[model samples]
Target: MTVVISAIPWLVVSLVGGAAACVPLYGGNVRRFLRSSLFVKVVMWVPLFVAFVVAVSGGLLTGLVSGVLLASIGAIEWLRRDTAGRTRWYLALFVASCAVWPISTAQLAPPLWMTYCLSSVFSDVTAFFFGRYLGRHRLPDWINRDKSWEGVLGQLLGGVLGVLVLGMIFGTAPTLLAGLVIGAASAIGDLVNSVAKRIVGIEDWGSTIPGHGGVIDRFCSLNIALAAAVLLPR
Candidate 1:
């Protein structure tokens, strides 16, 4: 409870900041702002550097640094450019990274957490690239076109393979199961965000991260995957 409470402010700031950033990316002034070298230098590059520092630090320090960095980036983006669709991809990546962090931290054994982290990253990265490269079969029109069965299968296979490799090293069912479940949940979270962005008619949730988008974009998968792991049995 204490940990959860402590995390709330950071979480809220991340979400709000990210949403604010998206305004510029999805707005109409993207091209005009891109031509401004000053905007790119101070507005774009600086916040990303700060986020990198915060993320690398990884603790209470991360929370404070990341929150401030995200807010600053969002504020700047909101005040500058507008480029839609691109932000969604960035957001997806961010959410995926966040999803893996808790699983990395929750393990009682350091080796187990390490294995889970490696496996989770491998699974998500493989699935993402594969899905993007080979995703031909789209879901029904009712579903978001951005998601495909190809991506889902890629996630499943990548996740299973990742867990299998990690389990071979760690030799633990609980850890393997946790990694697999978290990977699947991360994919689901990605789908949820895709749907949200589509429904809202925005691209990218925000432009806080240089390559990434907003806090929601960065942490959407992490939030869902962690929540699922916490609520589900085992």
Candidate 2:
């Protein structure tokens, strides 16, 4: 039952992610870039990391491996481009935070990890559908025009619903307010990433994820949302 409940969102995200990436409305370049982004983001990374976790026990060793691996990759990318002025400190902070997520999950309780994933994944998933289907007004067309108030609605509903369902399956119910807060945090994370991308002058983070850009692109919301959850009063 736990497996089934958790899987529901994973499947939904994959389907929605694929659509968001390859949809013809965006343009040929979008489809071309995002087509690979979706699968790599959803499929390759988590499973690969999970296997790594299993091997290293997702503890200190895992953190060390993840930090070194991510930092090395970031360094390689930086070297390849070699444009120091274009890169910002926040981008480095973002990458560092990505390393934190796996470490946090390895160290923290299962519920907290699930909270972060539930909020972030469902928010993105529902936002895609809501923005595409029901969205009429684009609230902030600055970085990502597709993000709408209506999509925010979907994120809220989906986040709340996803948390409640997870709670039910686990026989532990968090406050509805907590769910709302998580949803809001997830939205803020997404917005921040959008702004970061614009400032960095990149469409997606990298082609690492086939359709999603890179680990940084896909994991930004989860990292910030997790931090917010830690800071927020329960």
Candidate 3:
């Protein structure tokens, strides 16, 4: 109805941009970041997601904000002395992917939002542990020294678990499939953003997001995962 109609454009844009990012990923770097900061960041975001569900019921376009919330990461490109086509591509795809989930909420109901966002969070949470505790094999140093097969496995496990739980809580049966898609997509999106960070010669996207770095640093993978959910039916 009204919601679905309004959401189509963002969905189309998200799928297109996310597809563009699906390349033979080289890998991701073992990034340096503050552990305490990460903890604070998660603590803050969890409530926001919960509030988002409540807000959706009361009619707020928080989804639109979700879609573009991380687009500001593009600003760093201006700081680069050697900007290239990569900058433009990353900026476009990043913003488009970020925009998708908001549009998706417009079409779907509150439960879908819960299922999608939680899947992304779980994927990241799992990946971090897997990468830190068990990662040994370094990808091509040029690609990223920090990523490993274990991290990938963790992402899948986490995404699936999150999606399944939310699906059950929300009473959405078919959302189980989201585990496979969102887990993988979110990881790929993270790797893509890692590449962008390397090119710009920086770390943590920015330090403005209160222990999370910047809006982009925190939500890069989430946006990509949300884009995947948008393409998925039910």
Candidate 4:
């Protein structure tokens, strides 16, 4: 609990920053750079390596490895003539590191944390696919078309279900609230990412997650949501 409370804000800021950075990499101009073989290699491998390190280790080691990876990616992005896909790989890598470190350390209370993580995952999964398939009514033109009221509803339902189940297992209002807030926050976070990407004229963020795109692509919403859960009143 102490660790969670202390880490929440830092985590949120980092995740948000990383997500915002991805805009340049995956959004509107992606094709201009992804066409390059080097850009493809960076996007695919750098972030994954960062995630793996963070997952296996915590503390300074995680930070150190992540920093080095981000620096390398940033330098490459800057130097490479194809500025289009340049930031995508580094942004994806940074988000991956942010997510994996906390989750790996959160194993302290495996059931509770895992429940929280799983619930978040389910909510995001449902919302993403559902939004893509069923969405027709559009958001305000200012907001990304990718996000919809339908998706938010799906997220809310999924979050509520996740909280109910996890709450039953944990038998605590704090735990239940944590799940709810995190799920909602995660959905909001996703919107935040989309908005940022749209503002910068990017698309998928990065290609780190295979079908998913980037780490921010996969976990941006969840991480922010979970961070909110940690800070909320128990």
* Best candidate (score: TM-score): 3
Clashes of each: 13, 8, 4, 5
Ranking by TM-score: 3, 2, 4, 1
Question: What shift in Å separates residue 214 of candidate 4 from its native position after superposition?
Answer: 1.2
Our tally of clashes for model 2 stands at: 8
State candidate 1's TM-score: 0.51
| TM-score to true structure, per model | 0.51, 0.69, 0.73, 0.56
In order, what lDDT does every prediction score?
Answer: 0.52, 0.61, 0.63, 0.54
| Model 3 root mean square deviation, Cα atoms | 10.6
lDDT of 2 by residue, 119-190 (tens): 567677777678877899886646677578888788777778767766664445677776777788778777
Candidate 3: regions farther than 4 A off: 1-35, 54-60, 72-86
lDDT of 4 by residue, 185-204 (tens): 77887776676566556676
Predicted candidate 4, C-alpha RMSD: 11.6
Clashing pairs in 3: 28-144, 63-102, 67-98, 67-99
lDDT: worst 10-residue window of model 2: 48-57
The 10-residue segment with the lowest total lDDT in model 3:
23-32
Worst 10 residues of 1 by lDDT: 1-10
